[model samples]
Target: MRSAPGEFEIIRDYFADAPIGEGVVLGVGDDCALLQPPAGALLATSVDTLVADRHFPASADPAAIAARALRVNLSDLAAMNAQPLWFTLALTLPHSDAAWLQKFADGLLQTAKAYGVSLVGGDTTCGPLSITIQVTGSSVKPLRRDGARIGDAVYVSGELGAAAAALPVVLGQKLAGEPDRDAAERAYYFPEPQLATAAAIGDIASSALDISDGLLADLGHICAASGVSADIDLHALPVAPLARQLAGERALELAASGGDDYQLCFTVPQEQVATLEKLGLDAVCIGTIVEGQGEVHAWLDGERWFPEAAGYEHF
Candidate 1:
């Protein structure tokens, strides 16, 4: 059996080579990371925590855990059309397993490289396994939920609910069988944040949010913030193919209520629809904003449909 390494040894061996650029004066090894901000853009920051049992299976691959923890925060940056510059990680482990740490660092560093972000600084400690990531980004005219108008069209990026569909499989509650099963498990393990397309959409999307929670629930947040109502065409939701195959009759419900999709949901004004289309974003028009209080009227084939569960709950 491999021996557990000490904290500094783990840092030196695993996290010491974190990529640095974009005004990062110091990273990882320093007492505090020093950063120089770029001009002409506003800074955007987001933080996310992933707990072992609540977020992922306790026995999940350490690399997958690290990826999920960081990607979720990056999703927040994508929602605001922000580009990530730097990030810090705080990891708590039951034991300092060197192999696990190495896998985790590989995942973190690779994702950081793909997203053009540097690992600035962080701390490690012993405890129940959990990961927290703080991401720093920049944006010009950050998308705000309150910016939607009554005439705006609501849209979403990518297909939804595959990750949620894999939950039963992840927990081993369902027997793994089928092509869809593999697809769903892949989505659950490595959810791709819509960072690239988000930048492409840019200010064309007036109000935007990442669908970390279920589509309906996260859309409701936008409605509440904008003090507007919406008419969501349930059939228009771009449900993932695997989600439909796996969920069967519950596909729509899962798409509306299943969290962790991490797709971008946004609205564009009637006048700006052409501009948004010109950007060639992989988004679908799912609903329309209207003149009313924050009431979301979900419709399916000309009739209203409401589900029992809304989405994942923080409390």
Candidate 2:
């Protein structure tokens, strides 16, 4: 039998050939990657770690895990209206299985290439399975959480709650029809980073973020940063069909507070709302920013509504 691969062997055999995009002075195989940011543009960077059984199932396909890991980190750049550039991976594995490593690397590099990002450098070590990725990008006009103002309109891209509702199916805690299972897996493992949507609204949005911790919870971040509150029309939320199919009447609530959607939620000033409409983007007005101290109020049919939980908490 072939001996299990070592760290260097794994790196050489798997990740060294990642796409070398523009501005990468040096890529994988270096102790530290050398990157060049666009002239007069700011660098936007974010990192995330996904642990086995916490972030994903331990028995999940390695490729799917890798794809999800990179895509989620890329969502951060999209939130900042940044252009994808480079990334680094630090992977931990309990054992170095070549087949598993190949699948993981293929998924990682494919997603990276699709996003126009290059794998710069990373490390591999022996431990429980986990993936840590740091993505860096460039932004000329970065949207910030603190930019929202009272009277701004809140909007979200695509649909929501599908990923959250999909979780039960993904974890095998709930049995689903094959169609539902496929939809759940797609929602959970392949959330598209809203790069194009961000680009379309970057100049007009007052504040922006990707919804990873449900819409309400992530929107609260913008409210806190901008020192404003929001009043949402719960009936106006564009609930995902997957959520509706799986969660029944609770779909709306799941859409509001079940995390993992990775879609963009942004605020557009009343004046620029017309401009946003002219762009004809795939987003819908869900609420309005109001004068308050970071509270998010929801109303259903002119009556107050509440969610069962705030969102996913690390603790």
> Between which residue pairs do clashes occur in model 1?
none
Tell me the number of clashing residue pairs for each predicted model: 0, 1
How does each model score on TM-score? 0.94, 0.96
Quick one: how many clashes does candidate 2 have? 1
Error of 2 at 2 (Å): 25
The sequence of per-residue lDDT tens digits that candidate 2 reaches over residues 1-315 is 343332344566687668899998976654567887889999999999999999999999888999999999999999999999898888888988988989998998889889899888787888899999999999998999999999999999999999988999899884545547888899999999999999999899999999999899999999999999999999889999999998888799999999999999999999999999999899999999999999999899999888999888899
Model 1, span 40-117: residue lDDT tens: 999999888889898888888787788888888988998888888999888888987888889989988888888789
* Model 2: per-residue Cα lDDT at residue 183: 85
Q: Measure candidate 1: CA RMSD.
A: 3.3
Local accuracy by lDDT, each model: 0.84, 0.91
